[model samples]
Target: MELHSHRMTALVLLMAAVALAGCRPEAEVAGGALDATDGDPPATRTALDPAAASAPITLEDVMEFDPRYLIGISYPPGMERYPGLAAELRRYAEAARAELMAAVEDLGPSSEDRMRAPYDLALSFDLLMETPEIVAVQAGGSLYTGGAHGIPLVARFVWLPQRDEMLTAASLFQGREGWHEVSAFVRESLHTSLSQRLEADALAPADRFRLLASGGEMIDEGTAPEAGNFAQFEPVPGVDGRLRALRFVFPPYQVGPYSDGVQTVEVPSAVLLPHLSPEYRGLFAAG
Candidate 1:
């Protein structure tokens, strides 16, 4: 989601400035543990001024868009009355359902719980799709006391089926008290899948080194109750105050646009560090 801020006074000043001068993207590179070359390359960084006194912010500093910012999951304004919204939502829902089905096919059914498993789940799947973003203008004043304007988190991309897919597991557990029987396995499977996928991306020796050499950025997209309360997200900054880093969900990579949902995607230090992985120590020396 994007927001535009204009102060009556600042707008006039900006106009005058723009009329006289042009703007440029800023670059400020510094030594840090999280180097740009080591992680997901960031988008362009444009700073107003490095010497100016103001809050320090970088492209990676964006906050997540969560449910707290939504007005409900339906169409926004004139759209509900507009002729195309319902059809559009239906289209997105169908696409999302197809994607989910593909994921289910990949996972297949678990040996024991055919009902709860993806291939043979007892309950049905329900998809939830949120409306896409639209133009917005604030008629009122600042949301914050300090004259800071607040932007409603707009839904940029949404393609969930608008239905929920739930599978009951009581029969599989044989009347077990809780999820203890399968929760851990499910978590492990997700973790393993995510790790392998990330590792596979770094197939080349240089690529492996690049990925494991540095710490990447992280973002906390706010929660959205309307979209089944799915968490929102933003990319984290690299050491150079740049918006450079891969922003993916952890674990269940099958369901996310960016991340798979596991906390960190990294090669074990033992695997990357020379002495830790004795067999690879000589390999590092050669490099």
Candidate 2:
């Protein structure tokens, strides 16, 4: 599940209100009013090349509202070759910018104490996998809004090149039953990982107790293999470059305190083959 930025949520609600009033905001390009700068320019290419494994997907900065907030957006250069997918990526970046701006507005005019330090907002995307069949991107970062700490988020976008469609967590499974099995596997993996962490001698007894208490909530089905909970995942590849396991990602505070940082666990494809739909089962099968 993706965490909607405050601004994105507000914008959606505002749009809905406008719709009820029979009006709408004029559409704008991806960058909107932000002053764009090539923060980390990617490699220049003459054409779309999905198979270009070494190609760079760089990030660009939108600093029009800097000192108040900052946003970084990017789209892989060759994405335009796939018009629909390119549009989706552009829209995603634009939405991220809207969220950052909305966050700044929600803070209102900064006061002297608030002005002591500038608010921070950042969004960036990374291409995690680029197999011929699928391409996966991870988009997320931290946002601070005059709080005790900033909230970090991570989301995954998997595109099926052959189908020219995006894959949701549910779509990757066989059916409702398949999802349930995957969810159970995720919960068990989390429990095992967390137990190992707690048993480590590095942590103080009090810290371990606190973690255990706070992390207990994560053990149930509610926090298990639902679409939202497992939004960020990737296929783990073996030495032969074949898919071996499915790795699920969990950002901090998702399953434990921030101090615990991000957590990840992988379930072997072999173990999940029975629960996978025919379409993906073959892809995950041993090479």
The most accurate candidate by TM-score is: 2
Give candidate 1's whole-model lDDT. Answer: 0.24
How close to the true structure is residue 46 of candidate 2, measured as C-alpha lDDT?
23
lDDT of each candidate versus the true structure: 0.24, 0.55
Locate the minimum summed-lDDT window of 10 residues in model 1.
Answer: 136-145
Question: Model 2, poorest ten-residue lDDT window?
Answer: 36-45
In order of appearance, the predictions have TM-scores of: 0.19, 0.68
- Model 1: per-residue lDDT, tens digit, 44-139? 112213222122221111111221110111122232222232233323333333443453445434553332222110011111212221111111
Taking the tens digit of each residue's C-alpha lDDT, what string does model 2 give over 1-287?
A: 02225543533443333233323232212211111121211111122244432233333334333556544343433454444445445555665556555666766454853453345545544456777777766655555454454545355566777766666676777656666776777777777777787897579889988777667775563366466666567767666666788777666656655666666678788667776767776567462
In candidate 2 the C-alpha lDDT for residue 63 amounts to 33
Stretches > 4 Å off in candidate 1: 1-72, 75-177, 203-258, 261-287
